[model samples]
Target: MWFRLDLRTLDNPALWEASQNGPVIPIFIWSPNEEDIMPGAASRWWLHHSLEKLGAKLRELGGKLILRSGKSLQNLKSLAKNTGARAVYWNRRYEPLIQKRDDKIEDELKKIGLEVKVFKANLLAEPSEVENKSGLPFKVFTPFWKQCLKQLNTEKPLQPPINFEKRELEPESCNLSELNLKPNHNWAQGLEQEWNPGESNAHLNLKLFINEALKKYTEARNFPDCLGTSRLSPYLRFGEISPKQIWHAIEESGEENWKESQYLTEIGWREFGYHLLYHFPHTISEPLRPAFNRFEWTDNSDHLRAWQQGQTGYPLVDAGMRELWATGWMHNRVRMVVASFLVKHLLIDWRHGAEWFWDTLVDADLASNTQGWQWTAGCGADAAPYFRIFNPVTQSKKFDPAGSYIHRWVPELRGLKPPYLFEPWNAIDIELSAAGIRLGQNYPYPIVDHSKARIRALKAYEKIKK
Candidate 1:
C-alpha cells in the first residue's frame, strides 16, 4: 500500500483493498520534487511526528511501514523488484501537479506488469463526480454544494483490515530522520506544544468537539477567545482523519437535521475549494476573474513586513498574525480580517499573503489557501465584494468584546480595557502610559489609517471595474 496523505488505517479504502489482495507492504515515499509547492516548515514538522505515529500503529498491527526518499516512481520500482509485488494500491491526492504525477506513475507501473489501483479517500465526493446541469464544473459554491448534497455518499466508512499479512523478508527501509522532514531550527517548539498529530488523536479531537463545542459552533465560532470551532483542519489535511469519518460522526451525533447544520456547510466549503482548484487550476497563481488581473497592487516591503510580524498596530490584526506564528494556526474569523487588511488596507497582492500563509499554517492546503486569499481579495469564484473592506478595530471589538483574544496574543495592550485596547493609538497619553505602551516603541501605531485606506481601496477597485 503506497501511503501519501491518507495516514490512517481505519476508513482507508486503499489500505483495505490492498490487504484483501495479499500480504501488504505499506510504504511512504518522500519525493518533494514531485510537488509544485513543497510542504512548508510547519507542515514538515507535523509530518515528522505523524509518520512516527503511523509507524508505531503499523507495528502494533503486526506490520511495518517502509520509509523511502527520492523520485517516487524510482523508489516504487525498486521496492516492487525487491519484494516481487504484483500490485500497487494507494489513495488519491487532488493537487493539479500531484494528479498529473500520479497518472504518469500509474502508467509506468502498469507497463511493468503491475496492477495499479487508486481510490478516493480524502474528499467526500470526487471533483469529477459532481457537476452542474450543463455537465461542467460549477463556479459558484451554493449551486455546486447543493448539487453535491443530492449525490452525497452516505455509505459507512470501511473498518481497518483485520486479515493483515506481511512478506517473510522485509525490504530494506531508510530511517525517518533521513527524510529531513523536521525543521533545522528550533522554531517548532510552539507547534509541538500545541498539536499531537496521529490517527488516534484525530478521533479523540472529533469526540471532544462533538461533546464540548458542536452545539454552539454557529455562534461561538466567530469569537477567537472561545473554543467554538473544531481544531480538525490539520488532521484532515494530513489525512489522519477522513471527511467520511467526520460525516458519519455527525450523522450519529443525535442532532436533528444534522445534514443542514452550519458545521457541515464548512465541510462543504472545503469540497468547494477542491472543486474550484480542479476546474480552474490557473487560479493558483492567477486570478479566476480576468478583470482582477488588472487590479492595482502596491509594492511596499515595509508594510508587508509589518503585517507579517503582527506589528501592524491594529490590535486584532496583530493578534491574529501573532497567534498564527505561535500556534501554526489562527481562528477562521481573524484569518479573513488579516487577509483583507493585507490585500486591501496595505494594498499588497493577495499572492503575497497566500505565500506567507502557505509557509506558516500547519493546515496550509494549496486549494484552501488559494481559494481563501482570492475570496478575501475579491478575485476568485464566490469572492467577497471588493468594496467590503474589513476595519480591524471594529472587527476586534465585535468578535472579541472583552478584548481577551487580543490580550492573549498582543500582551502589550492587555493593560488597557475595551475601546482603548482595540485601537491603542486612540487612547490618551496618560492611558498609554498606564498600560506601559509607547506607540512607536513597544506597540506599533496603525500602519494605515482605516478611513483613508478603505477609500483608496474602493477607488482602486473602480479602476478594475472600468
Candidate 2:
C-alpha cells in the first residue's frame, strides 16, 4: 500500500482494505516533480515529523515504511516488479496536478496488469457525490454544504484495522533526513515548539477539543485569545485524522447540537473548499470569477514585504503575521484579517498571500488556501463581498478584546492598553510614551490609512464590477 496524504493507520480505507487481502508493502515515493504543490517550509517540517512517527508506528506493527526519492511512477513500477506485488492501493488527493499525475500512474500500472485502487479517505464526502440538483458541481457553499449534510451517514466511520505483518521481500530505503524536508536554517524552533504532528497527537487534539472547546466554539472561535477553534487542521490536511472520524466522534460525543453547531459548519466549509477545487481546478492560479482577471493589482513588493515580515505598521495585521512567522499557524479570524489587509489595504495581489501561506502554513491545504484568498479578494465562487472591508482596529478590539493575541505576538505593544492596543498610532503622546511605543521605530505606524485603502480597494473592484 502506498501512502500519499493519508498518514494514519486509523480510519484509512486503503490500508484497511489492502491488509484484508494479505501482507501489505507500505512505500512512500518522494517525487521531485511534486514541488509545485510540495509542502511549504512549515508544512514540510510537520510532514517530516509526521512521516517519522508514521514509520515508527508501522515498525511497531511489524512492518517497514520504505522511502525512496525519484520519479513516482518509475519507483512504483520498480518496487512492484521487485516485490512481486500484484496490486497497489492508496488514498485519493484532490489537487489538480496530483490528480492528473495519479490518473496517468493508475492507467499505466493497470496496463501492466497491476490492480490499482484509490479510495476516498481525505474528505467526509467526495465532490462527485455531492452536487447540485442539476447534476452540476456547487459554486455556492450554502447549497453545497446543505447537500452534503443531507447525505451524511455519520453513524459508522471506517474502523481502525489491526496492524499487519511486513512482506518478506523488502525494498531498499533512504533515511528521512535524505529527503531534506526540514529547513536548513534554524527557523523551525518555533514550529517545533508549537505542534506535534502524528496520529496519536491528532487523536489527543480531537479529544481535547471535544472536552474543552467544542461547546464554546461558536462564540469563542473568533477570539484569537481563546483556544476555541480546533487545531486539528494540520492533522486533517495531512490526513493524520480522517474527517469521518471527526464526524462520528461528534455524533458519539452526545453533543446533540453538533448538527446545528458552528464547529460542524466549519467542517462543512472544508468540504466545500475541496468540492470547489475538484470541479474548478483552474482557480488555483486564476480567479474563479472571470471578471477579476482585469482587476488591477499594485504588486508593491515593499508593502508585501512589510506584510510578510510583520512590519506592516497595522498592529492587528502585524500581530497576526508575526504569529504566523513565529509559529506555522495563525488564528482563523486573524488569517482573514491579514489576508484582507494584503489584498485590500495594501492593494497587493491575493496570489501573493496564497503563495506565502502555501509556504508558511503547517495546515496549508491548497484548496483551502486558494478558496480563502479568493474569498477575501471577492474573486472566488461565492466569495465575500468586496465592499465589506474589514477594519483591523475594530476587528482587533472585537476579537482580541484584551489585546492578548497582539501582545503575545507584538510584544512591543504588550504594555499598551485597549483601543491604543488595537491602533497604537492613534494613541496620545503620554499613552505611547507610557507604553514605550515609538512610531516608525519600536512599533510601526499605520501602513496605509484604513479609510483611504478601503476606498482604493472598492475603486479597484469597480473596474471588474461593470
Candidate 3:
C-alpha cells in the first residue's frame, strides 16, 4: 500500500483490501518536488511525527512500513521490482498536480503487470459525486451541501486489520530522520506543546470534542477564546482520521438537528472546497471568477511582512497570525478576520498570504487553502463580495467581547480593557499608561485606518464590479 496523505490504518480501505490479498508492504515515498506546493516547514514537522506513529502501529500489526525519499514513480517502480509486489493501492488526493501524477503512475505500474487500485478514504464523497440537473458543479455552498447530504454514505468504517503477511524480501528503506522533515533550528516548541499526532490521538480529540464542545459549537465557535472547536484540522488533513469516521461519529452524537448543525456544515464546506478544486483546477493559482484576474493588488512588502509576523496593529488580526505562527493553527473565526484584513484593508494580493499560510499551517490542505484565500479575495466560486470588507476593530469587539483571545496571544494588551483592547489608538493617555502600551513603540499603531481603508477597498472593488 502506497500511503501518501492517508496515514491511519483504521477505515483505510486501501490498507484493509491490500491485507486480504496476501503480503502487504506499506511504503511511504517523500517526493517534495512532485507536489504543486511542497509540504511547508510546519506541515513537514507534523508529517515526521505522523509517519513515526504510523510506523510504530504497523510494527504492532506485524509488518514494516518502508520509507523512501525521492521521486515517487521511480521509487515505487524500483521497490515493486525489488519486492516482487503484485499490486499497488492508495487513497486518492484531489489536488490537480497529484491527481495527474497518480494517474500516470497507475498506468505505468499496470503496464508492468501490477494490479493498481485507489480508494476514496479522505473525503465523505468524491468531488464528482454530486452536481445540478445541468451536470455542472454547484458554485453556491447551500445548494452544494444540500445535494451532498442526499448522496452521503452512512456505512461504518472498516475494522483495522490486525494481521498481514510481511514482505520477506528486505526492501531498501531510508531512515525517517534522513527525510529531513523537521527544521534544524528549534522553532516548533509551541506546535510540540499543542498537538499530538497519531490515529489514537485523533480519535481521542474527537471524543474530547463530543464531551466538552459539540453541544455548544454553534454558539461559542465565534469566540476564539472558547474551546468550542474540535481542532481536528491537522488530523483530518493528514487523513489520520477519515471524514467518514467523523461524519458517522457526529451523526451518533445526537445533535438537536443534524441537517442544520453548524459543525457538520463546516465539514460540508471542506467537501465544497474539493468540489471547486476538482472541477476548476486552474483556481489553485488563478482566480475562479475571471474578472478578479484584472483586480489590482498592492505590492507593499512592508505591510505584508507586518501581517506575517503578527504585528498588524489590529488586535484580532495580530492575535490570529501569532497564534498560527506559534501553534501552526488558528481559530476558524479569527482565520476569516485576518484573511479579510489582508485582502481588503491592506489590499495585498491574497496569494501572498496564502503562500505564507501554506508554509505555516499544519492543517493547510490544498483544496481548502486555495478556496479560502480566493473566497476571501472575492475571486473564487461563491465568493463574498469584495466590497463587504471586515473591520478588524469591530470584529474584535463583537467576537472577543472580553478581549480574552487578544490577551492570550497579544500579551501587551493583557492589561487593557474591552473598548480600548479593540482599538488601542483611541485609548486615553491614562488608560494607555496603566496598560504600559506605547502604541507606536510596543504595540503597533493601526497599519491602515479602518474607516479610510474600507473606503479605499470599496473604490478598488468598484474598478472591477462590472
TM-scores for every candidate against the unseen true structure: 0.99, 0.98, 0.98
lDDT leader: 1
lDDT of each: 0.93, 0.88, 0.91
Candidate 2: minimum summed lDDT over ten consecutive residues — where? 160-169
What would the per-residue lDDT of candidate 3 be over residues 1-466, giving only the tens digit for each residue?
A: 9998999999999999988887788999999999988889999999999999999999988888999998898998998888888999999998989999999999999999999999999888798878987999999999999988998886899888765655455689989999999987767888899899999999999999988999998898889999989999999999999989998888889877866789889999999999999999998889998888888899999999999999988999999999999999998889999999999999999999899999999998899999999999998889988878888888988899999999999999998999989999999999999999998999999899899999989888889887
**Model 3 residue 183 distance off true place after TM-score fit, in angstroms:** 1.0
The C-alpha RMSD of each candidate to the native structure, in angstroms, is: 0.9, 1.3, 1.1
| Comparing 1 and 3 on TM-score, the stronger one | 1
Clashing pairs in 3: none
The count of residue-pair clashes in candidate 2 stands at: 0
Residue 324 C-alpha lDDT in model 1: 95
- Of the candidates numbered 1 and 2, which has the greater lDDT value? 1
Cα lDDT tens digits, model 1, 1-466, are: 9999999989999999998988888999999888879988888888998999999998988889999999999999999999888999999998899999999999999999999999999998999899999999998988988898999976999988755556667798999999999888777889989999999999999999999999999999999999999999999999999999999999999977899899999999999999999888989999999999898899999999999999999999999999999999999999999999999999999999999998999999998999999999999999999999988988988999999999999998878999999989899999999989999999988989999999999999999999
Model 2's lDDT to the true fold?
0.88
Look at candidate 2 and give me any clashing residue pairs. none
**What stretches of model 2 exceed 4 Å from their correct place?**
163-169
